[model samples]
Target chain A: MKKITIDPITRLEGHGKIEIFLNEAGNCEKAYLQIPELRGFEQFSIGRAAEEMPRITTMICGVCPTAHHMAATKALDDLFKVEPTSAAKKIRELMYSAFQAEDHLLHFFFLGGPDFIVGPQAPARERNILGVIAKVGIDTGSKVIEVRKRLRNVLRIIGGKPVMPSAGLPGGVSKGINEEEKQTIIEAGEYAVEFCQFALEFFDDIVLKNKDYVELITGDTYQHRTYYMGLVDKNNKVNFYDGLIRVVDPNGKEFAKFKGQDYLDHIEERVEPWTYVKFSYLKQLGWKGFVDGEQSGVFRVAPLARLNAADGMATPLAQQAYEKMYSVLGGKPVHSTLAYHWARLVEALYASERLLELARDPEITSKDIINLPTETPREGVGVVEAPRGTLIHHYKTDDEGILTDVNLIVATQNNSAAINMSIERAAKSLIKDGEVPNGILNMIEMAFRAYDPCHACATHSLPGRMALDVNVYDTKRKLIKRLQKNSCTTSTSGDGVGEAVSNT
Target chain B: MKTIILGIGNPILSDDGVGIKIAQQIKERNPDLKVVETGGVGINLLDHVIGYDRLIIIDSIKTGDGTIGDIYKLDLDDLDASMDLTPSHGMNIATTLRLGHGLGYDTPAQIRIYAIEILDNTTFRESCTKEIERQIPTIAGKIMREEQLCAIHTLGSPLCQPLQNRPVSKPKPRRAR
Candidate 1:
């Protein structure tokens, strides 16, 4: 049997190492996914002012600041018992949609796009968006920049800034949009919708052209059944901003729909000795281990999980795409996380359609963008569908409006268990005993990047360098292979690279 | 001439956000001073310093021997290989600064940086240790005095003589009921 270990998986957000131990018989014996850093965000926010949750939590992540901001705001709002006005809600939704559009575009094009477009084994120097741009020409790069710029402009109009907008407040937003701003937002929204449509065509062409990737598409093969979780509107349309928590069983059956505050009852965090990040699972399901099986509660989040949870897309084009995806996945739960990119594109289409609706809504032009109350309740929960997955921020406060506790479940946390599973599966299937050819390990790491794990923001750490080390040993306890790579340095852009590779 | 002060640091990461906090304090004293908070070394930095003729950058520097709150007046031209300025972002600050200079948009004519020596950058908790927080007021006061002195010096200089006695406009009063 052979044993292989990859320490500090490269191109990921946080510090983590994966070790795969195989016995003399060449079968997998044990797998360990380790996250080195401890999460102290919850404990640190205990004595802060309740109203500062949004701003404070925004610091949790530079990549997904909007997620932390929205969740923190929502939690504070719940505590305060403040419901923003119609215009306020509309503005918030628009800002969030803009964030979704920008963030998803960043992930799909800059982060995940390279994997599909550029072959995985391409030198570390040629595995970045810049490298892809050099090969593909300026037009593609300009498209991405244009999309991000337009999205940032839209978000700026409402949120006050593009990246970490300071708009959200406890009761409502701090600022309101005037007529001129509204018109600007409307124009930008129209442009975004058009851009998204163009991107859909672009992605469709790419998907059709790549037959190898097409095989990964579910339809009927691979894991296509698992529990689903997300938010929905009263009419059952997909809601990204706010709604009661809903969970559906593997067979498209509704399991539970509970208020956001009630999440504590169903979800319980289980700490594994290997990883610092805790694995949250259904309280009743228990830890059935990482292997795929019934009652595992190993449901994932992201585009795939969101699509599975919702009935249909809010927009027509997205709905059509959703139908196509469902048909391909054999109707419901898409367990194969590899199909997340397809789901992301479909959701991007949906977000564009939703933008058009909001832009057209007459109320969007109104002057009353903020509705804040003088007093608020002592505790609250804010939940939103972040680009990566569902994000929840729970905050409790003292009588004097001081924060007593803060619990955050970021998008990366939602996929914690699923990430481990993907790593294990990829490791077992790809790594042969003491040998994982160069770039094969990179592929396993790519599986984690599919979720775009934001360990920096999730754990409230400033962005830092990441290193991955992999070791392989033979049945005789002889070291066969050892690999060490830095996540940022390996990619040409000094950012994480995502590419697919095949080793013969 | 309008001056923009930028504070770049990770606020939760111990000493990172010190620059921003100092800028905020200076802004409170002089509301006209545009104080902006930024996460260091990115395209965002390029955007922030675009039109500023005079920019004051405040950040935390991990110099081996300097006292925690020691102030330094750095010359942009003198920024050679010897300086130990570390950008809080992934890319090196020197590289980003070089990129900005290469872009040829009017780089800051005079850029001053006040760096605080950092003790710890790993914690997520807010509120710097008492030693660091105490220096905030003194730093703010020093920056304010420097601006006033610079304005006076500029007025007195023969090269910038456009009528030194031009009436100083009074700041708009806060609206009262």
Candidate 2:
């Protein structure tokens, strides 16, 4: 027997690896996704002041700081047992909507959308932002960047977009928006709404109208009947900022609806030996391994899941987009993972519309933003629907308002099992008779990338800016091949963006 | 040229915060130079990066091949010329600058990237490890000197002073690790 190890895989953004095992027949047997873990976060937060969490948690991941900040602030509100004033809630939601809209748009243009915009089977070199720009025209990129700059500035006002202290405080925010600031938000919101509409039309023209792409989306290789989880408003409409957590069965039937404080009662984590991530499953369904369907406990979060778990969008244009999606994709709970991109577009539109609505609210410019807390501090849990999925922040504190413990279940963790399952299913479908296609890595990556799993601290994965890794083993557990896609220099020198290498 | 120093890193991720720390030190020494510290996500970089004639970006990178505190001055074109355009998950600096130029956003003409070799970026601690923490003043001074570029002296701004002789007090940790 022989073995080769890609040792010390650390320090890349969203650093993850896939290992595929082939049986004696040389056919794909099993595949697993492994991500490096960020250490000592609970220990790091144990002694911090309770109120500082809103600011501190923002540092958890540079990518989703606003999501974490919003979650942590809500947790503080619970800890002090005070409700935010009406104006404060609207203000917070306004900033949150901006964050979600900008984040989703970025994902569509740069992260996931390229797979469709540039066509999946295109040459590997032509499958990134530049490629997307080429296909979508230079103005699309310019529009995305321009709209994103405006929306991002609005997000910075509360979540410390430029790395200032957190403006979020318990019971409410620290301050209200002035009339001038509200005008900027309104204009930015309108611009985002227009861009998202254009984006949907682009999708309709490129993906929906194309027969081959439609078949690819509806194809079983990218489909799953897993339970879906999301946060929804009182009317069962998808809500990003705040709402009751909802879960729906594989058949698109309502299963559970609970507040953030009761999350532990409905959801639980299963620790697997092969990976550090704790895969989340529905508590009532029990742990049923990595299989999907009603018997399986595995549930998914993020765009597709949020839309599947809700009735409709809260805003009008988004509601139309939602209806059109279901009508075209064959109704509720579309099992196709590729539909996540479409769902992401609909949600972005909703977020933009909601931002405009809030921006226009008369109370948005009111001075009564915060309400000071008077209750004794203790334990509290906060929840918010991040662009990726539902994010939960749990905190326990001493009587003096100092944190005693902190636990976070980010979007990636909640979607971990489904992500792994999606990867394995794709690999199983793509590889046959022990023959692995050269393009199998991208094909398989498209499945999990749909979930946009950040692999937790993706705060930093300093593995020399590497992107994808795939390893294959034979029945004897011997290394057969290794494929790596890296754009980093091996040495501390310039001009060495290494090419993809495969060894057998 | 209106210049700005854009420091990029995660503040709570040990060595990853090195960029922010060095940027803060540079600002403390010369308040006249505009400094903005950010995690540098996607097009957000475009916002802080545009409207400046000259831009300096300092970030932490772990090639797993350099001294923990060593600084590497990188030109914009030296980046992965054909890779996906994103810093972490958004657009990479080179592609972003290209996009800015294409969009006619008044992007900086001269862009210098300072990548500090880092250790222990995976940890949740807000401060860098002791070894790297001890070298902050030296690293900050070196970057400031290189960035000053003699033009600031002609502008009547204070010269870049060696910070090694300045007070050697570390910021108080939220709690001892």
Best of the candidates, lDDT: 2
Per-residue CA lDDT of model 2 for B64-166, tens digit only, reads 5455776766667555343542212645667667767767789999998877777777788878999889988877877776666333555754444333433
Error of 2 at A72 (Å): 1.0
Question: Docking quality tier of candidate 1?
Answer: incorrect
TM-score of chain B of each: 0.73, 0.81
What TM-score, to 2 decimals, does candidate 2 have? 0.89
**lDDT on C-alpha atoms for all candidate structures:** 0.64, 0.80
In candidate 1, what are the lDDT values of residues A1-504, reduced to their tens digit? 011111222232343566666678564455566655534676788877887777777776666778778888778777888778888788788888888877776667655666665545555434445555665667766666667677788877877776567888876787777778777777777777777777667766766467776665432222435677788776556778887667777776777777878888877777777667777676667667665555786666678877777777778877888888778656776677667877887888778678768877888777776556567467788889888788888887888888777777777777788777776666666666545656645666567667776654322221222334555555665656665452323322321221211110
TM-score between candidate 1 chain A and the true chain A: 0.88
TM-score of each: 0.77, 0.89
DockQ of candidate 2 is 0.21
lDDT by residue for model 2 (A226-282), tens: 999999999999999888999999999999999999999998988889988889999
Please report, as a residue range, the 10-residue window in candidate 1 chain A with the lowest summed lDDT. A1-10
